[model samples]
Target: MKVKLASSYGFCFGVKRAIKIAEGYEDSATMGPLIHNQNEIDRLKTDYNVGLYNNLTDVKPKDTIIIRTHGIPKNDLKDLRKKDAKVINATCPFVTTPQQIVKKMSQENYSILIFGDEAHPEVKGVKSYGEDQEDVHVILSISELDNINFKYDKIATVAQTTKKKETYLEIVNALILKNKEVRVFNTICDATFENQDAARELSKEVDVMVVIGGKNSSNTKQLHSICLENCQDSYLIENAKELDPNWFKNKNLCGITAGASTPDWIIQQVVDEIEKY
Candidate 1:
């Protein structure tokens, strides 16, 4: 099989910045998995002595704490600062933009609506910035809009950094139709747009598609979804070991794309493994 790589794939600006920041702070711990990629996190742990802390209670006073790229809840950050830990924020500027927007809008008394999965770390962090927690609502789809009862006449909305733009637009459209005053801030990362578009185009031309990234990665799953729409033989895998030789049987062309959190090393490993098949 001839192996093809997507025109745009691998680490985005935010992921790259986070990795660089973490590398400099060896022996420190990240509040959460710095980025979604486990392979890179493992590499950092082994090579740099960086540790992972899943909760605020795990953090110690004066400990070096590097914030995850996804950021933490507003109150969590405040608590961490109160502990006197050396807090280094690695949040992607793209994600921070929406958080700030939500903070400002909520303080101004505008109901905040976030278009994202409530369970996602990014969405959770953004939702916490609202002055009135009850006014802040998170929704995964247009259907959830029905459950929201905004107290304020004016509303402001933002999307998860890695969400599909088309889906966000649908929610925005619904809000505009029902609400008299709506403030929409485009929060989707530009790199996400490039990566998803590239994956969609490559999947259309290949016999099989391989998306490389972490299992917990929202953007990687989105890429897999896009690929599946174009090629049913699309597989989402974290590493080369997960690749099945049977998936590539008789396939003439294999296209590979990765989430923004993926590294070049992982992508190369997948490509090398595919070539062997």
Candidate 2:
């Protein structure tokens, strides 16, 4: 049996930078998980004494607060500033691009349309930038676009950094038909595009595909979806412990790809375990 790894996989620039920032601070708490990977979060907790908090109210004034890579809502930052908490911003610059665009466009009276999951932290942060959250619409697909009744002639659209380019463009193209004037910004991260493309290419050449990453990671989920389209036997797992030998019974070549937040050690472990078969 042969094990193949995607050329572009594992921790991206943002995740690496966030982890480095977190490691530099002691007894610091992140607004949310610094990145989606549970293993890496656990390692940080044990090694760096970092903590995680989901709500702003839980943060203490004297404690250092690390902003997540996905970023926080605009109002949340203002509230934090009002407190005495020491803040360390770890938001990816890629995610910040959309937030800035949304803020500027909303100020100019253009209705905001975000191509992403409404519940996602990154999307919520982007939506908060708009002057009025009511004017900002989060649409995951073209079907959702049909339900939106836009009263504004000018619309500005941006996507979550981890979203697929094809899906984002498709929605933007449809939105252009409905609005007289539309401004579209493709905010998908270059790393995300390269990772997905690499995953797709690996899926085509392998007998089976393995996607390793946190289950909650949006980018990881996207990579798994891309792999599933080309390879029916693709499996999504967090670690080698979850791997079932039965899946690789007759497989000669297995391809492995991980999400942006996944660490290199986890990928290496999965590969080493697969080679044992």
Candidate 3:
């Protein structure tokens, strides 16, 4: 049996930055959860007085606010400052671009639509980027757009940084058919695009694929979807301990891929466990 790993897999720059900041400030008592990864959150709990609050209303003044890579609401930040929390920004630069674009669209008086999963923290941050007058809509699929009847007027669309390549284009093409003035920005990060493309390619060559990342990880879940499109034997496991040997009983070749938030050491352990089988 042979094991192949995806070339474009592993942690991206943004995840690294967010995690690095969290680790650096772990000794501080004021930091919050750096990102949504449960493993990382557990590690952070040992160092900082981190609380997972949906809103900032629970944030105290002395707390050093450790912002996640997805960024936060402008009002929330302003409110945090007012409450005297020392803000430690950890937002990813790739995500910052869409926020800047939204500001421009707001000034141009265009109705905005964000293509992404509505429940995602990144999508929520993008939605909060809109100003008072600009109306931003979130679309998970093309079917949802039928409810909003708007003409070929000034309309702008931006994608969440980690959105799937195929789905983003499908929506863009669909919108182009309905409105003449529809503008789209494929804000999906370069790393995300490369990772997904590589994972999809690997799925075709391997009999089984083992994806390593937390379940809540957006990019990791997308990688699983890409593998499922090509190979049904794909398994998503957070770590080596979760991998069941039965899944690969008759497999000759296995492909291993990790999410942007996955650590290399953990990935190696997963690979080692499979090798022992």
Candidate 4:
């Protein structure tokens, strides 16, 4: 079997920046998983001495704390400052843009509508910036928009950086149709668009598709979903060890793609393992 790599795969600029920032601060801990890839996080722990703190309360006074790329809640940052810890902000600029947008628009009295998973850390952090928490609404689908009751005449919206653009547009169109005054900010990351497009294109030509990234990663899951639409044999795996020999049996070609958070080393490992088959 032959192995082919997607045109756009592996680390995005934001993830690369966060990894470099984390590497610079040895003996420090990140408030959360930096970029959702456990293998890379483990690499950082072994090589750079960076630690993970799942909660804010786990952070200690005077500790050097590197904020995760997803960023944390507004109050959490304030609490970190109060703890007298040395804070290293590694939040992706793409994620930070929506947070600032929510803060500004909400302060100006526009009801905030975020098109994303409500439980996601990125959405949680962005929602916390809203001046009026009651006015902020997070929805994964356009159907959920109908359930929201806006207290203000005007509404502002933003999307999760890793979400599907097509769905976001549908949500935006629905908001415009329902409200006279609506502000729409396209917050989806460009890397997400490229990765999804590449994955879509590659999946069509391969007998089997393998998407490499952390299972919890939103963008990785989106890639797997896109691939599955084109190729039924698509699989989502974090590393090379998860690749099953049987999946490639009698297959002529295998296509591989990775999420924005996936590292090149991991991708190469998977490629090497596939090549052996």
Question: How much lDDT does each candidate structure score?
Answer: 0.94, 0.92, 0.80, 0.95
| Count of steric clashes across candidates, in order | 0, 0, 1, 0
TM-scores for candidates 1 onward, in order: 0.99, 0.98, 0.91, 0.99
lDDT of 1: 0.94
Candidate 2 lDDT by residue in tens digits, 148-258: 866588999999999888888899888887789999998989998889999999999999999999999999999999999999999999999999999999889999999
lDDT (Cα, tens digit) per residue for candidate 4, span 204-255 = 9999999999999999999999999999999999999999999999899999
Which candidate gets the maximum lDDT versus the true structure? 4
Candidate 3 lDDT over residue span 1-277, tens digit each: 4689998898899988887776776444322345546666666666554545556777776777777888776667778899897788888989888887877886687778888888877777778877743377888888898876543267788999988768888988888887768878879899988888899999999999999898988889989998999999999988889988898898899999988888787888888889887
RMSD of each: 0.8, 1.0, 2.3, 0.7
Q: Write the number of the candidate with greater lDDT, choosing between 3 and 4.
A: 4
The parts of candidate 3 lying over 4 Å away from their true place are: 29-33, 47-54, 132-134, 150-152
N/CA/C clash count, model 3: 1
